[model samples]
Target: MTDTDIGYRATRRTVLPASLRLRYRLTPWWVKVIVVYLLARLASTVMLVALASVQGANPWTGAHPGYFDYASIWDGRWYDIVAEAGYPKSLPIGADGTVQQNAWAFLPAYPFLARAVMTVTFLPWSPAAVLVSFGFGLGAALVFYRLMALRLPGSTSLFATVIFCAGPTSPLFQLAYAESMYLFFLMLALYLLLKRRYWWMLAPVLVMAFTRPSGLAFALAMGFHVVYRWVVRRRDEFPVRERVASIVVMLVAGVSGIAWPAIAGLVTGVPDAYTATELSWRADYIGHVHLVPFAPWIQAADWWFGLFLQTSPWLGYITLVTVLALFGIWMFAPSVRRLGVDLRFWSVAYALYLLAVFFPQSSTFRLLAPMSPLAGAIAQPKSRTYRVVIVVLCLALQWGWLLVCWGVDGLDWSPP
Candidate 1:
């Protein structure tokens, strides 16, 4: 038989054995889902345990020391306070009964969820919150796997899961932070967008807005996607009514996402509450001190270069080069552009986010974490050498942030 016929026959016969057919029929969908879910969970657990062990064994402790002790280091304490009681009139008093001025410091959704969990389960808020974060992170990884599987082969999807779940930044999942939850919403939004399920995408986009201000960026990015499609596709192919509906959906999604923060600000009468809370602590930080046009340059430097080197100097230098290299590859490689993914849209959104946070007085690393997944998705390399370099750099930057979080003297940029 010719090669084509032989291949075709092989494909048909592969499914023919009665025993093999029975095995396939007997396999439950839930069983497969559970197995993949457990795999991701197991990977996250391992990383968290490793982080906890290192912190527990370390001799020199910083401001807040312990496995997840850093929770109280920056915005973490604020979240805990918010969970115990609603946003206080003013910051809570210390153990010594000293009152502080920053009461509207915490973000709303995470702490609110933590408070609900604490009230319902009667468990300590810290551990309970961390557990919830962990579960959400695992779910996010699974969603990422599902999304990637749509665009890549099964093996690549599995590799992407490993890169996402077990990579250096996995420790974020163990903390009482909102990265995991935000990521869960992000993945859900992306899945809905890919499936063209516009209404489903709106729900998670709304949840994301409450989780963090950057959630609005996702909605805007989706809006951009809709516009790009309309601009590129032939006008005659899409009816005017359908085009109008698409525009309406994008507007509703974008407005709804921003509406949450606007409502929160109005209720609190803190017009710039989000920005104010973020910058309150770092008001004197170099990036925030500059103000206006100059602030963007300083912030970009701090985020793209400063934070890494300042926190972990050696890794910082390596990461700086890696960042440049990845950007270089993306700009110069035609193959990467031709890969059919909207890498440019994500890259632009990320740039806007970086600029938006420059003067916000938050740690560049924490502010930049949400964009890492998008970066990873778009940084796929065409050549073997490019792949190796990109992967190494990504892992280095990710792990470097983990060390910075653990080792820095004043590392306190959790999403309160």
Candidate 2:
């Protein structure tokens, strides 16, 4: 017991880790979000490289062969095209007399921003796309964490953010995909609504409408909230100006959601140009115009049921059972209630919208990214052990999903 032990203890107390802890204590919440997002991006990058390095995997290539090639596939390829060449003047008709897949089906917001960054900074398209996503994605994380903290304690909010970053499909945020950009706008719009800044929500709503198809979900939620306040609540509790602001938010959002497709149609001189191009990706590639209400659900049921039935009829039955189980979870889970009315309804409506319009393909996970707000339910549980277990399980599923969906040849069957 002596001078030697005292000297060792004294030296250890002034280590780099301890100093860094002191700095972290002084750091702001937004900076912590950036750090977490960057770390998550690093982890996802490692996973991507490992998956791509597997022997016999299809090269994610068209004009080039490398990581960027993988990043520029499926919807990403369309976005890259729009960024580089810009949209076409007319619909490219196929030999079968139906519309072919073209840039019109894709939205312009992310591509335009990426293009602008490329022009200003001289980065290549791939790097520019990544930069846009990484920057916007970090911003979205900041707002999302703030919103969560508003509803829950700081510790729980931070925990939920970690779980979200480590989610099975969150790798989309790391890629040069538009979901991250779309998420930034969505979160901003929601934050504006939360802060009671109805007017400020307009800009994000318009941008979000051009970013992804889910913009309407936000508009619907805003409109619903407005109606709920005026009709469901006491008349004396509302003000005329607030009601007018609410209506403006609703109308502006609703119009913004439809503006792009309508523009495509007007520019092309084909009323259904946008719808036709979108439907060109379906199972029946040249199906009719956009799906009517409930059609996507029917198509999804038929498609999944038939797919599973090929292996065994019982498997088809199991598919229905799985759906019923999910429905039960949606209806009964505490997470649903914990998200509050706006986010909960938005998640459910957005999920339904995706099911209706999008094929139940591999990229369905990415399409559902807007429902991230629902993940707030994860923060409701008080047990630290439970949160840890959930994060571990999510990461494990993420790795497995990467291996199964990405580590293979003929990768076109699944969208990235």
Candidate 3:
């Protein structure tokens, strides 16, 4: 990126009051990140509280539940169960003989971490789980800043961090969920991979694998990283040792990605324990369909098309193809390319992973949060108006997402 494209964090010319501007200029970058995170979380908490005030009694909470109670509902309660009762040895089977929803689907790392916190702090599951998310979210923001700084200017990277913190899903940071913790580990892993710190990457990569279903996507990224390096070896040196390390890491990542499933199957004495549990969540929407690789999107497309448009399902396929084509173009755009090849590789790999296995649903946004490095691309242009517009849209959409997904309508179909 050109110097003109990304100026210093604070310009000599500004509209701010002199004293406040001076204080802002003197503050540390990390401190600024903390302030942004805190302020963002505060805003999200406010939104959640407002929703909680009106929320009617549901399976998870009483009428007009408080902040922690509301946040602890949904997937947070699942994590709480995993932490308290642990996974079942025998899978719960429904009358139809399909696997019923159980603790096996939720990963162990985040909830166990919360359990540790609960032991020491004497806090209940709701508070402890939210604390885990809050703390790790701050960590994620800090690491995200450094990762963006690797390629963009410090100011631009910081702005990108701002975008991330204030993004629509910022509410996840305060909820009793694992997304914030997973993002911390995922971003740290990507940062290490980008720096070619092969050995160091193992820590976050393995941990994040258990934190979320990230192993396969990261392994795919490693594969692409290796090929990209080999293709450009004439300009960028790709040594034998580096290649060996990269290949080994890729294989390890693949193993880590599937490790949880293997463990679930073994312990439960059901060969498809993990996959079946995950599929059970969607059975309510798509019925008891068999799991097929790279087929979920096609099926989801038809399902969604038939549900909404009540017309030809082929239109859905064409729309999916068009979206993929546009996304591919965006991946190669000059602004995104500037973030480096590894970031792009991760984006593509994550996209492919989602396409192969995920059905289009309300949870898709949360799943896509791992590929958020592209925020740097948006924050690159040094236009105050543009930045303000982007941030404003983020804030507005924050409320929109809360209204549509977070708020519990009676028998709600949409979930965040």
Best by lDDT: 3
**What C-alpha root-mean-square deviation, in Å, does candidate 2 show against the real structure?**
3.6
Candidate 1's residue-wise lDDT over 288-313, tens digit each? 33235335544544654556445544
TM-score per prediction, in order, is 0.70, 0.87, 0.94
Report the Cα lDDT for residue 127, model 3.
93
The digit string of per-residue lDDT tens for model 2 on 214-246 reads 666667788768867777557546678778887
Q: Cα deviation of 81 in candidate 2 (Å)?
A: 1.0
lDDT of 3 by residue, 60-116 (tens): 988999888998988998999998988899999999899989999899999999999
In candidate 3 the C-alpha lDDT for residue 226 amounts to: 92
Put the candidates in TM-score order, highest first.
Answer: 3, 2, 1
Best by TM-score: 3
- How high is the lDDT of residue 254 in model 1? 67
Off by over 4 Å in 3: 1-23
Clashes (candidate 2): 0
